[model samples]
Target: MNDKMNLYYLKQLLNKKHVMLVYAIVKMSVYICFVLFVFFSLFSIDFRDMQLSQSLIFATEEINNSSSLLPGVSLGYKIYDTCSSTTMGVRVAMALINGNENSALNEQCTKPAQVLAIIGETQSSVSMTIAKTLAEMVKHFGWTWVGALRRDDDYGNSGMAAFTEAAEQLGICLEYSMSYFRTYSQEKVLRIIQQIKSSTSRVIVAFVTHLDFEILLDVFYEHNITGYQWVGTESWISDSTVARLDKHKILQGAIGLAIPNTTVTGLKEFILDINPLKSTGSTIFTEFWEALFKCKYTVQNDSEDTTVCTGKEKLSETDNEYTDMTLMPFFCNVYKGVYAVAHTLHDLLGCNFGTDVSVNSFRCYGEEVYFDKNGDPVAKYEIINLQTVEDHHEFVMVGIYDSSFPAHNRLSVKMASVPVSVCSESCPPGTRKAVQKGKPICCFDCIPCAEGEISNMTDSIKCEQCYQDFWSNPHRNECVKKEIEFLSYDETMGILLTAVSITGTFITIIIAIIFFRYKNTPIVKANNSELSFLLLFSLALCFLCSLTFIGRPSEWSCVLRHTVFGITFVLCISCVLGKTIVVLMAFRATLPGSNVMKWFGPPQQRLSVLAFTFIQVFICVLWLTTSPPFPFKNLNYYKEKIILECQLGSAVGFWAVLGYIGLLALLCFVLAFLARKLPDKFNEAKFITFSMLIFCAVWITFIPAYVSSPGKFTVAVEIFAILASSFGLLSCIFLPKFYIIIMKPEKNTKKQLMSKVPVK
Candidate 1:
């Protein structure tokens, strides 16, 4: 009896199923006759809720209401919810491609549907998966240097992997890759925010759905992290909910790829006119109405907190989500997707509308809908910036990313409308980059170029060295010609020294004239008038040689000055030494048994002077032939100026010349000191001793001053010493003799010379 009842129930159930199957076929055939073209749209309706679904419905209504595209034909669409899952998205895409909503694993579209194109799987991972299954159609939109933020699921991971691979092949750099979950922990969201804040990339390509990004934005708002240039996919790029977030300032100046939005005339009025009573089939609209009015629609199980709707609530006055057109990127994508299918069908069907030839391309609104070789719509994305208009933050049309343009010029961003974020400030000109340790390439220290080097650009890696004849300016930005410096006659010190040298020469000449005029005078004759004349001539030469040290040095002057000065001074000192010996021998000859006077007579005295002077001449000759002083440009003394001076080529040879002169002077000084108390009027021994003392003192001081001095001062010190010593020699030896000869005629007599003789 139970088997008989089961068979009757099964027969009745089968009969009802057959009737329903026939009804479904009859309904599908009737709908297919009216549908001129069909396109499928995949969205994350479960995760993103009503917003994603509403975007497609509103876009379909806009296309259906428009009379411009497919004048007589109607457009139809089928949408599937992926629940923000890549696997679901793939299944939905494959089902649409195979024209079988129930087919889970169909490789080919055996039962091909009339669908022309697939609009989207809003999430990046879902879209990437669909695109990969659809023959890598993502390459149609070229993007480089993008930061990826993906969901921490199979959808996000696989999508990010595909994008990363394709980006690498296209030479695109992934600045950062972060992951988030649908039900993310606060710690994870905070960590993602911190990573975004620390990343140097300004363009963040978010591969998450609307809800995932909303959570991230909430964390970003809490931390006050902003100025991230978000390159959004279709998911949240056009999501009106993100614009309605409490802190929308975080998204200001963000740029993203968007479906070019067109004015769907009366779409706002259509959305505003919607009510739960009028839209009986739209359960999402009823939910939207309740959320908008903060009221309940049903009275069956009403709670104390649930307010009953008056049915008079205005969507314009309420917290509505679909009023603004700036947040309608997804709506435009669906609208274009419908038109893309209509245009493809219109071309494939050979539909003639006022033309003999059928149109292969169709312009829907302002966009030209055409399919590429891969059967995907020609990728045309609008670059939208999240800008503030009045008090409302919304997407502003800033630029376009057209696939038709060249790769470099494809994405045209309005830099003025975009905000920049970087790890470090740009290093200004005149500074070079010093990379910070343990920091990103963008984070670096600005260091000024080193001495003699320059950096003319911002963030230069290394400073360039200036040319040999050039130097860096104060700012180290450029090279400037070095100042040509030399010991010239126009300088103040040079003029003063030149005047002093001329004066000393004049004084020496005057003394020479005085000694010559009084040649026969007893005082003059007593000092040996010939030796005095020769000494005066040598002193005049010494004063004139100092003039060389006052002017610009040259190769000729460098060699001339040192050699002439050395030889002349030696001649003068030799004359003094000759006089000292003459004085010693003259007094000793008066001692009756002194044979020393015979050994050194007037001829021998001349011979001794020549021999002593010849030694200095030999030393100077060796100095000139071996390593003579030459003009040198000294750059190390001062940074800005060159010291044009003579370089003493051989230190030993130069000192040898001075040492020889000193030896002669020291010997003369010692011999003169021994005979300083000679019992004779107008004794020349005291004058020689004093002159040698002054000469030694001047030279001793010159050594330190010369060594310590820099640039032209070194030359000045040597010249001053030469003039002082020469003057000392001329004054000490001849002044007293001139006093007696010119002023005291009686003292100049030979009797006066013998008056000071000591009685033994």
Candidate 2:
């Protein structure tokens, strides 16, 4: 044959070593046999599909076993692989046509078994020696490689141009584009089929009217051009006449953007009519068996299990798309959601479904959605249908859909099953639509929403943003509130801080009691008993104030946390300042002609302590009046949780309050340092000086930590400083005297106060 010589020359010219065509054959030259040339994946041995091959053989066996269909005919079939290529399929087809098993007229096209009909190369794209296109609708269904067919008129050309431009943007490539005119010859039509049979595209974008589409449909039917996905413009997509005219089922599952009012009357019956034993309209019955039964006839290449489908599985026991009519809504939306057009009935009773639908609306035209307590709409839908009532076509209510009901109970319709017409499946909840690159918005990849974001509805373009304290749950369906955090007494750190503060308070109280028990003693009297008692009281207040920072922050707690801290610390420091001044006065009174103790007595000491504490009180009040510390959530500190902490509003006011306490502490340190060496075993100045040193050190360290610490730690740091300073003052000033008074009773006498010697 000339075809064999051309391939030989082409191979010689290209210098190719790989086999372009390969097949197996049996000599059945006597009786007419069926040549079943099935398509198989050439590359990747693990992925080669043998289902179509099995189906052809199974059908042949089933037909031979059957007596009613072909009573006298004992049909024979020769199965072969076509390598899923048009050129190979053609060579194989030629070889089958020659009816030679070994060497034929074209040796390159050899391997022919005696056959009557050329069943297929399996896929319609390859069956025509091949076949087959959306830019959005095309890309939605992942038809990247496609062909374009159009009418010669302006309508077809303009529409196709738009589709082409969009397809190009969406990364869709057209292998062959052609037009169908009213004056085209039969030969021209055959050539177009020849082109389609040769092209590798499995999808076709037909931009022609319903009327014009008939011209090409006839040719398509003659060539058995079904299987390739068809996408049409609105001008033809909704035409029921064209859908009915498709006898070869060429446009069975066609989907595109348009309001399709067309419904196939015998669709259920037509779908159920496809049975391998009854109908020979299709050759790939094995694939259909696997799809309908949800089982594979053969184990996969990667799998070693011998388990395979029985092939005797009954369709009566299966509930698949073919049998289940209650599965979904037939008309699926790819671009936009189905907007509820609440068309009213004659009497305005209630909402209508389709044709004579009755709907009730506040304004009859307002498209407002009502929301529930959770801020989500509880949608109620009415199914509508067109009906002829009193010789007038009207919209009739058919069924209803209440979103508030449970999943299986939401819809109540009279119809047996719903038809789902879609370019691509819907993106379910928890996922957001990611538009395919170079494609339209409708053709998108369903990517899961990021953590902390959620998508409640199907086909959501963007995820919803959570509130300030809320976050997305694991499923990403709803926003749940984040965990609240603070330095509460319940936690480990909070319990420790609280215990220390309480222990420090009790210790200060016991020290006060000890001082009171020994009030008549020389050591207690010499250390200015009145100021000592007040100092102990202030230390106790300091310890207790820290407990305020241990619990949840609120308006009251926030105000108290800072103000109480400022006032109590200032009071404690002032008492030390008073004692320091008293020591200097006592030493000066021992000088010649000096009556300094008279002017600065216990009464004056009390006034100075009151005056020092009063300054802190005034600062705290001003801070509160202008800008008070209040409860605030620190979100940036941790992304997973909210930090329930107090905001020290107006840094100037907080610093001023703290600075005043530091000024008092610093003054006490200087004066105490001056009198530290001034006489006596019971010299209180030395003890006062050490206490001031600890107080100043603790407070000075607190400034940086307070500013640097995050969330609950900042509050913890402040409490630590308060407790540390209080303990410092209590131990340094009171512990020594208590040792003398209780442990060394001999030193608790007047001799100690007048000795003018160190304790050693």
Candidate 3:
């Protein structure tokens, strides 16, 4: 009965409003503490260097202090050290994923753990083992012609194998793949360095941890190996230990992928305020202090050789090596990871600040950290150039690789800042690339294009031929229109030859007039006056025919020039032949048995001249009707010029015409030689012999000169031959006759002519 009454009184007390309000406030306070204790775990390297640890801690603090991220819900974090080991990193990652470091394989988390997100494993090999999505990020960077340098271990071997397969699918050529180790012997390290130095690849993609890279770099420094464009993994790119090395000069102009860095307000001040005395519970702070100040804590002991820390050193004034906010890419990754968990939790709880919230809605420090469909943060990377500034090496953000940008513009690097990693320089215009045997495409020999071919761009594969009417310039870079060339009256050679030809023609005319005026004289009659007049007329025609070759070639000039020359010269030789025959007959007639003089009279001489001239005319007519010469623009002989000259349509016809003239001259010369000893006053046979000799000499030389001369000079040579031969005939044969007819009129009488000649 007593216990029943006590229970009734307790129920009455619980029904009071003030007692219920106090109970509800205490329940709300416990729930708030539970939310604030839920932590995001971060796995980073902190054994040899504490930059990554400091970065993760600073990032977590920044997100926890932000009120806009997760209102009324405070955030907490748990940090784990991987010691830059893949084994340790995997254990850490699995512990975070499984919610228990020692849980059985079958044991699953019945409730969500306080840890929400795991930041990183830092090293690429470790990241590959834990984060399988990192291969996509590497693919996004689009590196081709890359060299793969990895650690000689399971993490590196597996990661590089997967990376190489993915790279092959993306059409990336692996120039060389090599392995390294921190415990490598000096000989082995030398061999690796030699391989790197001899490799044609200039870009080396290193998939090694910071400690392994440092070891490899020591060997590289000993050998003075540099100028390699190192494409680093996240394992060492953001590590200040490598960046602050004394021999960092070897890494100048390196470019690599890095997580984007953002300023976390008040983070620098918080790090600078850390003190050993104030944070005695933090062993990391004490270690960092000793490293920064190069001093250690000493107790009051018997030994007096120890340096003691006063714990009064200012961290801000000292070199805050690991606390540098600017060089902290891993810090930003951890910072974003924490905020991502906070925002996701806020949406999960349906805590609306101003609008309806979704799991994807999240912003921290004014920057959104959204996860992709794969439940991974949207990958964003900064392309950084490791450059030297004020005698120290640091990474400068050169470009951004964002999926939001177009593919063509996505990977834009500052070309001036980026060094070229090619095997050879580019081939300039006017040349083509001649690829070397068993060598890369970039390693080729630049060769000039052959004559008449052109390459108008750099690294041209083949040269293109110019048009038939065009020719390549000296540089072989472009085709230029050929110059049209011919023997024109305006040019010097044409003008000179024309003047000479006209002068020869005028001289022949003047000689003809003198012979006509003294037609009744004995000297003119002694040398066959009709033949003399015909020969002089034919010589004038020969000289005038040379004028046809002086101007630009035309159809009429091409046909008439050679035909008229052949016929006129034949006529001249015929006249000499007729005169030689008459002289021989006259001498024979003066002998005891000589009817030759009567048989070969003026009529026979005329018939002889007409017959020879008619035969040449027939040949000329047949040549014109069958295979006529025509004006031709020849482009093949000279590259920069067009030879505007006549083409001999039939070579046989051209040679036949010249051969016939030569036959007539030879016959005349032979006849003149047989009658040269005759006692005639003038000895016309001697003059005919000399004239035919000069004509034949000129024609024989003209053939070779015409054949060998180029362009306009060929026409000039032909014209020169005509004028020379014609002048030879006129001066040799007619000049002596004119002198006797004008100055020695007594010797020109018929009685003197008959007395000078002796009968055989």
Candidate 4:
């Protein structure tokens, strides 16, 4: 968009009269004084800069509006488009100065256009067309951000001021700027030292004299400050004394300007060609011969301490600082200084710039010749570093900061992490960064994640909340699954319950074996051994069913635990009811005209037990098919863990199963109570009543415990109730018969079994 706009504006300017009428055979004279603005383009090829003809017009208008500035010398402008070409710019410059557009090179010229000053060609190449030619300015050490320092004296102050103006125009930011003279107090010097240490910039640009520069090197050396890339001016940058004083190697990597040295072509032959014999009248030439051979003239040579002088000594064989041209650029500076005076004198007399020129008038150093804004002898400088060469402090030329071009190989710097040394370090993992008041966003405090929260990444902005049924680890770096709680068989309570359950089943099996062995004995037969065996079998199943609840709650275990318990308990109760009915029928048979014994015989007794138990079996099947128990994770009960347990799918189904078992137990308890005082040797109905009472009591207490127990304990309580009730029935109904068979052999007779004892 900007390119298009600029192109359109330039096209408009091309159609204007003042620009189109710039050239012709006709002498179109203008009386007004003009400042020619030779510009590159509406848009520049280098994106960093844009040169506009409109700005020149604005500046001329502003200057003309201020009468106090020019004092009625109205400044108008003849703007020329150089098209970024040095060729066209040269033609325009010659025409403006010679006072006519067509006759630019006519030496016998007339002042016609009255053009006073030229404002542009904005491009460097075009600007130099007016001043003959030019090269690139010094290719500085690639630093765009820096800290500035200078001496407080006039020379250092003026040098730094020029750098400051250029730095602002070039868009470089100064982290800090300070100045101190050699006469400053220790406290003031310390403050400058503190500022240097505090600012994060690694590069420092110091424009100071050798005298003031020594102060900084000493202070920084004493404080042991190193790793700084120093940018120094020529005054102290080349000083050998300062480099030697940097003993701790504080400024070893420093880069700065220094006077250039050169071995000019044909210089050796030029020296060898000179002869003192030809210049015999000159005493200085004879003195140079004495110095070259380390000797004195004939009168002084007679002294034994000195060698004789030979004016005919071969100068080609000699090698020294002078002959080698080690300080050639310094002498070249002197040469340029001479031409500066000559140029000044020529300009004052209106002499053309082409005459009376020396190698000094343009750049004539190194291997090339060039012109720059800072004429030189050119701005010829070497980029030197303070380094340990050959185990001694040496000033070595690393590159050039001079007007000599071809700088692509010379201009290089490591563009490493610029802001690595921030105000504070990065926040570590498991912690969040918190910015403090009046501090930059890069600077912060690291705060650890709070309880139940975590930060998994380094330098996290905030901590995250853990999900439900999860928790944060010790380092607070991540969320993990919470520990699951359940009554696994490995735990103490589960182990104990399992042991009791297996033991009860074992004891019941032993009783059934003894009853089978004593099937012919009266005590066993009179008490209905078949019914006793069936009751013991049901009680063993009751004990085994509790084992289902003592493990990790799963879908199968959950359904098996409750269903098996309900059916086995019901079967046990049905056996007790059947025994209680037989006792009542036996008591009624002894009464007049009673046939109750015939109706409830052995086969009938078995059928009654099945009929009653079948009711419970049906209830269990309905409960399981409709709404069964399944495993669930209860997160609401605890904030830190999950309670992995069985959840009754339908509350109504669970309660109905328990209620039916309770009804059967109550029926047995009622029938046995009435027949407890029968006149028989062994009234089993009284024991049946006691066992039913114990079963009812256990389950009565169990309901509340099952509801109130939490987590794994809830499963434990159910197992406990099952074990307690099973043990009650086993001890109450079978232990006495077991004692008679094993310990009392006489009670096993039919005579003792048939003997009746009246109840009170």
lDDT of 3 by residue, 1-760 (tens): 6555444443343333111100011011122223333443222213323544444556555555667644544445555544334554565456555556344123454433324445554454234532222334334444345677887765567767877776666545566788877777878777788888787767777777666766767677888778777776666676677786637477777666677767766555654566778776766567556666767785566457656687897656655544555555555554565555555554544542334335664666677776666565555677777878888887787776665566665555563644445455667778899878996454678899998889999879889999988888999899988778998889888788888888888888888888788777778777578888888888888888888877888998999888988888888888888988987887778788767866788998899899999999998888988999999988878877888889999888899899999999898888888888778766788888898899899999999998999988888888888888888888888888777777777677777666675646
The candidate, 1 or 4, that scores higher on lDDT is 1
For model 4, the superposed segments whose C-alpha errors exceed 4 Å read 1-428, 434-456, 463-500, 550-556, 584-608, 633-644, 666-681, 708-713, 750-760
**Per-residue error (Å), model 4, residue 573:** 1.4
lDDT of 1 by residue, 1-760 (tens): 6655544443343333221100011011112222312333221113133444444556555555657644444445565544444565566566675567555444544675423356654445235633222112222333333467877765567667776776556435566898888577777777877887776667666666566765677677778777666666555666677776736577776555666667755544554566777877655556556666778778666578778987678767855444555445554554454555555444533432333323346665565666565555556666566677888877777767666677667656555633444445667778998878975455678999988899999768899999877999999999999887766789898888889889999988998898888788777788577898999999999999998776778899999999999999999999998999899888888886778877887888899899988888889989989999999989889877788889999999999998898888888889999989988766789899999999999998888999999888888889989989998998898888777777887777778776776633
Q: Clash pairs of candidate 3?
A: 522-748
**Candidate 4 lDDT by residue in tens digits, 639-663:** 6689998999988888988999999
Give each model a TM-score.
0.68, 0.50, 0.68, 0.52
- Output the better candidate (1/2) by TM-score: 1
**Ten-residue region with minimum lDDT total, candidate 1:** 19-28
- lDDT score, candidate 1, position 400: 72
What lDDT would candidate 4 get against the real structure?
0.65
In order, candidate lDDTs are 0.68, 0.64, 0.69, 0.65
Q: List the residue pairs that clash in candidate 1.
A: none
Supply candidate 4's per-residue lDDT for 232. Answer: 70
* True lDDT of residue 313, candidate 1: 84
